[model samples]
Target: MERFSNITEALMNEAKIEIESFDIKDGEKIIAYFSEIPSISGFPYKIILVENSDGIVYARFRQWDTEYDFTRWDNGVYNLDRLRIITDEKILSQTESALLKEYLSQLEKIHLPENINKENVIILDSSLWKFGFILKNKNIDYTWKAATEDINVFVPLINLMREKYLDRI
Candidate 1:
């Protein structure tokens, strides 16, 4: 099988961006872990990558967070991502279920050692955290509001596939 991580690292490095990986030894900077999130969870690593003729580039990594998908803002609005869930892990056989549960419980919170966020970024007045990798909670501010309502979305056969995304992380 193709080593999932090697491919991810290659892509990120080629883009002149470093996705977080096991090889980093500098005490696991949060930014390092910031890249290649899904892969870090023993799942696929996906990035919102936009490459163009010019060298400038920007990327966002996906991660699993155990919380709600939407939040309210100081502006009295909500913020969220309308995900089209593609696969469900909950449909696994009974035997598979047992193993998956055990596997998820063993994962670490931070694969690296350094502080996850930069010094200046601070969450606001509310207490709700992000659903996955999203930084700002909409409850504190409407800055991260979803662009559109969900359309043509599919649910995974497994009920906890979404939860697995959080537990695995």
Candidate 2:
């Protein structure tokens, strides 16, 4: 079982990127959850809506695989290996792309905590918003908890992605 003491710390160490943290009250909260149930297949896939306490919202998506590894970026767009392409005639639809862009736009708006208690690991990429915590009625007390840190938030992220991918099939 892998443990991420904090999201920022795990991402910084695993992805080797630097991030600054602020007060959770000033950070973004999960507003809505979306999963496509018949498009893509296998692995973990998901999309999430996050909004700051000030009422600003955005979305981001993540996909994980156990095979093949590569990273490439053109202009501001990032294409990582073959995971970007689902099938010959079944690629990411315009709606999904637009939705992801909307989420990416808020990447710099939310505040991630400096430290959080975690107990598992999810293979993540260079994406900034890798993990999202689900809340109930905007209440932190209702957040989901997994036995291990990895099983907690990361597993749900993968499940969402899987649902979305299946939707395209």
Candidate 3:
């Protein structure tokens, strides 16, 4: 079985882009990051949220095509190629940005326990969800197979983003 960190590293390497690569002004920093590594039957994409010192927020969405060699999967490698930018560093309006920031704040308050057992879930074709957040004194990173209801807390944020930005794509 492949470790979740290894899978995340592979996906990040394949992306050729890192969250730190975004231009951050003196008072601006990345507040949160979310990514979905889809199963063989789903689409692959990532969403990043950044906020300035003034609480202004911006979002960027990147997607990739699955047109790569399937043989590499035997080695636990996912070939996510043909990069697509559904939303590129777009600044959200004040109202939407405030709402997004609120959602991020809510996520910060929720504590997802570590080492969740996956044996209970048996979905064969579920996506893997990853989330990262930078807080005042600590950073949080979590990943879980999308086969359990425990991860549903994130659904609202995902749905909001999808409805606001991804619906067109």
Give model 3 RMSD, 1 decimal. Answer: 7.0
Clashes of each: 6, 28, 0
Candidate 1 lDDT tens digits, 31-92: 10112222211223322222223322223344323132112222422222321112222233
Model 3, 1-169: lDDT tens digits are 5323336456655543532245557988776777776664345666777777887777877665444433335565454442333446677788877776677687667775554326676767677777766766677777778435655776666665655456633
For residues 15-94, what per-residue lDDT tens digits would candidate 2 score against the true structure?
22111111234576554443322111233334555566655544444434312222332232322222332221122345
Better of 2 and 3 by TM-score: 3
For model 1, what is the error of residue 86's alpha carbon versus the real structure, in angstroms, after optimal superposition? 20
Model 2 misplaced regions, further than 4 Å:
1-25, 35-41, 66-169
Residue 3's lDDT within candidate 3 is 28
lDDT over C-alpha atoms for residue 166 of model 2:
57
lDDT of 1: 0.26
Better of 2 and 3 by lDDT: 3
Worst 10 residues of 2 by lDDT: 14-23
Please give each candidate's TM-score: 0.18, 0.26, 0.62
Shift in Å, residue 129, candidate 3: 1.3
Alpha-carbon RMSD to native, per candidate: 21.3, 14.1, 7.0
lDDT of 2 at 135: 37
Clashing pairs in 3: none
